[model samples]
Target: MATAQAAAGRTFTTDIPARLDRLPWSRWHWSIVIGLGTVWILDGLEVTVVGNIASRLSEPGSGLPISSGQVTGTAAALYVAGACVGALFWGRLTDRHGRKKLFMITLAVYLAATALTAVSFSAWWFFLFRFLTGFGIGGEYAAINSAIDELIPSSYRGRVDLVINGSFWIGAVGGSLLSIVALNTDLLPENVGWRLTFALGVVLGLVILLVRRSVPESPRWLLIRGRDREAEEIVASIEQKIEAEKGEPLPEPAGELVIRQRESTSFAEIAHTVFSAYRRRAVLGFSLFVGQAFLYNAITFGFGTILIKFYDIPAGDTGYYFAVIAAGNFVGPLLLGKLFDTVGRRVMISSTYLLSGVLLFGTAWLFSRGSLSAVTLTACWCVVLFFASAGASSAYLTVSEIFPMETRAMSIAFFYALGTAVGGISGPLVFADLTGSGVVGDTVLAFQIGAGLMCAAGLVAAFLAVKAERRSLEDIATPLSVEKAPTAEAVTE
Candidate 1:
């Protein structure tokens, strides 16, 4: 590896980005996926457990004295608020410091907060802990998404990210099954079982923390920070590992990015980049995020309530139905993720969003007419979310890809914060109230609103989506600080 120190405020060139993009998929990449992608699973588990146990928490002998609506609405809203704040706070640090530092710290915060949640005895205590847990998971989103994009080969980025994001349903499935046991009087006492459910998340987070220790910082991020020597060495190490695993020499890396080395990017610069220069992309990201956030948050947080309140399904049986729904969510991304990289981003994103919206409208009509049983309604939900999950996962992929390298983490944070604030915070509260009404018409109205927002977002995507399939992140959006742009010939290579 070679070394170079930039003169103050001067520019330098490096092939680190190209070197990273050219490597073959190997265990090196799988380790990164396991270490970072598991956060989604943890988040899914947290959300599903709470939703499935809402009735348990609201019972008279349960430790908390809150109503089911309070448990799902107020607590869910506070968790989202914490996630919004955490995204901004940790997002800036992720871009400024480094991907490795913030991801590790954020995961540690999540583990601690979730552990505390298991011991909560009152509504306020539970709310505070849930907020803290959301705070940690929120930070993980900014840091992890940025790192994964920077490290993975562009050809694999779309499917890799979508599948990882969709893994939340893996946790959702686990949570649903776990709740069935936890809520079972024969297996565990009510209060004890609910507390144990939260503790399970802490255990999972701890295991991931150990795996993350082996993952390295983003070499592209290191180069931009003026640590050219470290960046070169890390890339070299990764290439060597990949070659060894493949038992053959790797192809030579092509292309070059010349950038002005900067110690840090200011929040003002990140904001200006999003709002002024890349304004249309900002709009696209916000629309995609807000739509999916509202729909997912509403359904995931309050689905159990709808089952119990509207269809007279017992609380214990909700988990069985939820497990089926979660399987559909997981299968959508697993099956459709490859198409995002092959079929292109614009068409797939729009089609999934529009189709899901159309399906939700059909679901609303059936429910309003009282024409569906609990099993039939659950089946309807599975089909609707199958398309919606893929669309929702693509939203994260869109924000992460359509921004400059320097602001990637913050871009994710900005849109995630704004979208969550608008949709995530309100979705649960609105659904909780509507579901509590126990009137099919009321819940039907809520479904229509969600369907409308999703359809509107799809239209926005069809107009503004970036055609970024199988392209390097640099090609999608040039780094803000690139000193000498790549020539036409180099770009084509």
Candidate 2:
């Protein structure tokens, strides 16, 4: 049974936050990870495959009559723009409805759009589908991140979130390998192979949908939405399963958070909460997100173009090099994820950002001098992104954790939209122009710009970062609905 005490103006207290934070890690947590986390993998796969096949889309007989620059620049920017819009649209819905509802809906949107993309006969058709695909993915970022943080125990939240976000690189590895096969003329036709690549994502999304159906809505969200009975029932069910697995009684939960339940939140309250109460966090979040978005968008969307134009590398071989780079990205989060939980968020986040930025600067210098081969250049990228990937993943983790539960999804959406607008869209456009110019110096200058932004963001993180490790979400930022108790006579009708 939930414990609640009446305070002023219908304010009531409950221990839902403490109860969730005290749960043990088990197969249940693994199920949540598999069900929700794999969205990032699908996103990575989609982006990488598109980047790898930019050249194929420009081929005369490939059904699309667009140039390589159009494919990478205009198409990529449209996708990010769609993502920005989708993040805000779906993010508001996620907060108003519920996490489970929006995540499943967004995933469905992605699957349908991606399957349709496989049948595109023109550049406009492809661009429309790509925008829809990004729209779905953008929604996933807000919904999934909020759900994962709210459900996972505080002790495990950092590493779990990082690993899940980093799983995008695992999809990258798969995409890279798949592209090598699909792009091979001897194995399959150019147009058919690229279409098949998108079809594969649909299959993966279907499987994830099945798993997602079994995951429950967040108990914390339910309680705050005035569904305390439902929240209590869900938590009781979870504790039963967990205790059954351990063959021991769970410890009693401590601490209670008092809040006046509200049916819905308004945009004005969200703006005031972010801008007035948590302005510093907003800055930190934007800095980290913009830095990573610029660096990643510049590299992922442009790497294939760089290889083909710069080093005279065959288009088919770009996937092989990309696979090597993807491996490094995956390894960074897998290896360094624990330290974010153990050593704490501020130090680890800043260090990863700074180190990756410094490494990228060195890489830019080497590339400018024409001192690197395709192979050697890829090795340099692997090193730079090993740290950058982890840092990038942490950006999502930070935004999700630092905001109030009521505004968690929207806060993530706002930052992602702003950062991607400024960085993600422009990175591809700038890099595509540089690649089209066929000047190593121009591309090197682009790399330095990405590196400098990363370093500056790292400095901001060092000073403004939230020390949120192993702390309950309520402790990190008290809910807006929380208020001090008044005498019974003072209670409003």
Candidate 3:
């Protein structure tokens, strides 16, 4: 059965089709995962940079002129805005141009914009640059998710993606650590630290670009787009890697072939495509996207402010808080990745949001009573942050796996755009309001509210996730057999 399954999936390994099961860890596959992973990590880092630098950015004489509140708030707003623009514009582009090309395009935008961020003279320049940086970010969600969904092998898909998705925290932690060093030192003005932080973004992007150059374009995409020759080349590359590893010539590509002449695709068609082939999956995906974006935004944007307000901690503590938070984010997904497959997405993800809510609420209460010692505060907060971040990956994992390929980018974009818009708008405003003297006086009631919403979102996801996980991650994203449809086509494929 295993061999049959392997043989049934076709690759471009030869002029004739070869089974794909025999080619696990093909060089091209690894390259795709690595390239996408690098971009994701950087996106997470760049998005969270404002949170790390909020105190300093908002402080007068910090070498940048702005209210810390304004800086943090505006950055949050811009990040979402940029992401919206990217998700909207790039969704179609990713579909039309193919994932690999779109990935490079976004990376270029990200690389250049992030580098220039170091040199902004005023808030306007900084704001505008941050928005442009968001364009890279916007494109990233579409490109990376699309590439990984198509390229990663079936068996290893869940665990590998879970872990790779977790790496986003690495950049966030890196940003926090670097921010700590720059902000704490009298060696450079506050502005210089932020500059360096963004400079490091340039270097990281270059590393990803270097890694990407060795990667092959998606054969699945090439075949679908009617670039059969390029698909064949990509397949040859995969076969070569398998042969080298196995110390034998690799089998050729095989399976039921349904080669169709490619047709031009348009932005408007994305909506039609998404709804037509995989409406249920599309709805679920959009829900997850919106919920995850809202919670993730709150955490990423509001963390620094919360720390500064609640802890009375100085600017350098941004490092400690962010590091701990990023660590939690990274570690939780890793520990939970296998369990996601085992315990099921419904349980793993739903619990993450629910637990995150409980802990966040608890954290708020502790803050209000002045009961949490510094150690306790950090430790408890890390626990909350961990679940939040991990839950985020779980949400993506579920959504990505469930949705069909026909309009994956479009659906993801909708979720991302709406969630960010809502979360981005609400996170700072709500946090500001909750932190006011009138509302539980330093109690994180606002945090509790956000946490509760996360819990609620989790519940909705959990209920829906059974359908998502009805088939394994490796399963083609086909509509349920009994689902109302006149005809069916591949959604997950």
Q: Which consecutive 10 residues in model 2 have the weakest lDDT in total? A: 484-493
Tens-digit lDDT track for model 1 on 202-307? 8888899999998899988887777777888889999989999999999887788788877777878888888888899989999999999989887667788888
Residue ranges of candidate 1 with Cα displaced over 4 Å: 1-8, 487-493
lDDT measured at residue 325 in model 2 versus the true structure, 0 to 100: 97
lDDT of 3 by residue, 1-493 (tens): 1231233223322221223434556556666777778777787676666677777776666666767666667666786788888887897788667887888888899889888777877888888888898877888777777677666655556666777878888878877777777776577776577777778778888998988876666666565454666676666666777788778776543333444324444556666656665565566555555566666665456656555665667767767777886888899888877776566677777788888878888887877787886568778878987888777776556655666454566556666777667776676555654552344453466666677777777777666664333232223454221122122244432
**TM-score per candidate:** 0.97, 0.96, 0.86
Residue 142 in model 3: shift from native, Å?
Answer: 0.4
> What's the best-to-worst order under TM-score?
1, 2, 3
For residue 216, model 2's alpha carbon misses the true position, in angstroms, by: 0.7
* Worst window of 10 by summed lDDT in candidate 1: 484-493
TM-score preference between candidates 1 and 3, better one: 1
Question: How does candidate 3 fare on TM-score?
Answer: 0.86
Clashes of 1: 0
